[model samples]
Target: MGEFNLPVKQGYGENQKTSCIKCVLWGKVAEAYAPNIKKGDLLVVSGEFYVEEWVSDSGKRLQPTIIVNQIQLAKKSGDKQGQAAPTQPKATEPPVDFDNDLNIPF
Candidate 1:
């Protein structure tokens, strides 16, 4: 239901403007991930690409779409590899007093 644009490199040391291509994801795949994703977030997607033709009140247009099957968020640059991420510390139990108790039955 949504689309994203990625810049492409035409040549070495040369920058050229590229057209924006639209990609679409469907079914439960889209519903499950659409809300979680945000703009400017890096992602790695595996899917099939195709061209879709449609006619609207304006005119006929062609849009490139990718049917995403798997999507994953890319790790940030500063994140270290082979290291476990930190977690919140658990609460400690209250200490018990045993010395104050006096029970002698011999």
Candidate 2:
């Protein structure tokens, strides 16, 4: 599995709040798309949402997570509707080593 942080914005003006959601992608989807995702790139994702709860030295913690089933690059603000986002060139080597376990501190 591969995971990334997605920033979400809600409400407007004075009431606006921004949150960072943890998204997890598994198997083929992670291998195919994870390498191409970059910071500042807008993405559309569909998945199951839930809160993962755990306890740490500090205290109990809750993390909102998404199990991404489908994901796609979203069109830029200047692009016309129905137009696809530009694709990045395929890399000769994988950008991340997914075979090893990630050292994520929970």
Candidate 3:
């Protein structure tokens, strides 16, 4: 059985400048639909992002990019890879704020 509802890991969207269709995100598709993903393909993605908001010399706000952090393919279609590899636990250290909430105002 394919595990669709799974936690997603942080990844970067691989794309270059000067492209007509700016919707080809190249990264690890959120685990939800990764079970049945093709090797390589472009997709229209939407997700929470953080971008640099700056101002030009004319005091005009420059274009801010929507940096995709956690994303998933909106749709999927392909063979049901019954042989989908078993995803293992994240092999890395804990997050930066793993210890405490630290919401107190010092």
Candidate 4:
């Protein structure tokens, strides 16, 4: 599995500003629906909408940036579409090539 870099956000008391790394995993597909992603460790990204928001200080002014969602991993393969949440392996297993490189003389 590839490495996923997630942002960390903290809330400032009494501040109405949205100081959080809000992101959506999935909302269009039926199997996947994540309206608001919060600060948690349950983010299992598999073709999931990966986004991060941060403030950049430019010339003594705070600039807010909104990045589009990124799919870290593509949709998993299965009997049906949108089946990446499950942990079951593929139905058909490919043959192993452990000894394929061995050259035996007759």
Candidate 5:
């Protein structure tokens, strides 16, 4: 089993506050789902939320966690499966003179 911190947003616009929630991914689900998740990528996660309380030598601690049942990458409104997301154009000029700009005068 592996753990991940998911950032949650509260409210909207200027009132938005972000918080990290602990999530646990395990077994075949983790192996398959983890790879596709990228940093800052939106995800749709469904699971059970629980808190674990324990007493240690010094004090008591409570840990909040989500036992993940399903995880999927959240797609933009126009995104379609098996199709590449639209990318911005890399400059308005042609690529023929690209090497000339990188000659580095060194």
Candidate 6:
């Protein structure tokens, strides 16, 4: 497993604040995606989210973590000149057809 800190921004104007979350990527996903990630690159990620608690000299510490299941590169913000988006790693397996798999009707 590989771990990284992802900073997330929320709200707007005076209410805006940035928080960092610890993300954990395991196995194939980490191997295929980690090398290609850059500081300014935008990404779309999905996974399990949870909080982990631990004790420290200061006291108990709580951290939010994500166990990334899927990740894809996204176009950088303000790229109005139509630059091509970053190439993504080829899928190791066929994508799940959620509708069919869950038997949900359109």
lDDT against the true structure, per candidate, is 0.54, 0.74, 0.32, 0.32, 0.63, 0.70
What are the clashing pairs of model 4? none
lDDT, candidate 2, 23-102, per-residue tens = 99776657777887889888877676889999999999999998766676776776766566754435443333333533
Best by lDDT: 2
Q: Number of the top candidate by TM-score?
A: 6
TM-score per model over all chains: 0.53, 0.71, 0.24, 0.20, 0.59, 0.73
- For model 5, what is the C-alpha lDDT against the true structure? 0.63
Model 2: lowest-lDDT 10 consecutive positions: 93-102
TM-score of 6: 0.73
Poorest lDDT segment (10 consecutive residues) of candidate 1: 88-97
Model 2 regions more than 4 Å off: 79-106
- For model 5, name the residue pairs that clash: none
Separately for all candidates shown, the number of backbone clashes (residues 3 or more apart, or on different chains) is 0, 0, 0, 0, 0, 0
lDDT of 2 at 3: 94
lDDT of 5 by residue, 3-87 (tens): 7899988999999998777887665556556666678766777776888789999899887777666665665555666444433
- The deviation in Å at residue 80 for candidate 1 is 7.7
**Candidate 3 regions with alpha-carbon error over 4 angstroms:** 1-41, 70-106
TM-score of 2: 0.71
lDDT of 6 by residue, 26-87 (tens): 65666667776778777777776889999999999999987776677777657785664765
Lowest lDDT sum, 10 consecutive residues, model 5, at 89-98
Better of 1 and 5 by lDDT: 5
Scored by Cα lDDT, where does model 6 land? 0.70
Q: Order the numbered candidates by lDDT, best leading.
A: 2, 6, 5, 1, 4, 3
Superposed on all Cα atoms, model 6 deviates from the true structure by an RMSD in Å of: 7.0
Total residue pair clashes for candidate 3? 0
What does the lDDT come to for candidate 1?
A: 0.54
